[model samples]
Target: MLDTAQYRMAEGDTLPALLERYASAAKATEEAVAALPDLDVGVPLPRTPWSPPEPEVWSARRVLLHLIRETAQHAGHADLVRETLDGANTTAQR
Candidate 1:
């Protein structure tokens, strides 16, 4: 099996390559979650040493909430970046 150190990429990778890797990882995550049997969102998550410093732990529902919040944050930032690069803006119209 590959060692954990092999996971780190060398400095030569391009932006597009990194973005593709990110997309693939996200897709795999979604597929894994979709495969799980339905359960209550409020079910308590298993405790792990990697728990966040603030909450210390989270319910299964909170995990989804965090994912939604993070995805929205990144998408909003991407919109701003795209607007800066091209003249196009995705602002809402009345």
Candidate 2:
């Protein structure tokens, strides 16, 4: 894990810079996942060297499922926020 302190953004940070950072990280993550061997998908994740240590690590498949679920959850939140700002209806009114 990275030192969280260094990644913190100041209050004056620009939106484009923050978005560029997100894009870079996302692209790197995608590339790393793509480079992994196909046979390792079901293997257990490596143990971390943390003090308390991780209770349970997830397999690649579980990680992928979690990513999918999280993305869906965030998308829902974004939709609500957008609707609130624009008064645009995302769903059919009953």
TM-score, predicted candidate 2 vs. hidden true structure: 0.65
Question: Judged by lDDT against the true structure, how good is candidate 1?
Answer: 0.70
On lDDT, the leading prediction is 2
lDDT of 1 by residue, 2-59 (tens): 2454346767978899889989988986885686575333444444455445444445
**Shift of residue 19 alpha carbon in model 2, Å:** 1.4
Candidate 2, which ten residues in sequence have the lowest lDDT sum?
43-52
Best-fitting candidate, scored by TM-score = 2
Model 1 earns a TM-score of 0.55
Rate residue 67 of model 1 by lDDT.
Answer: 78
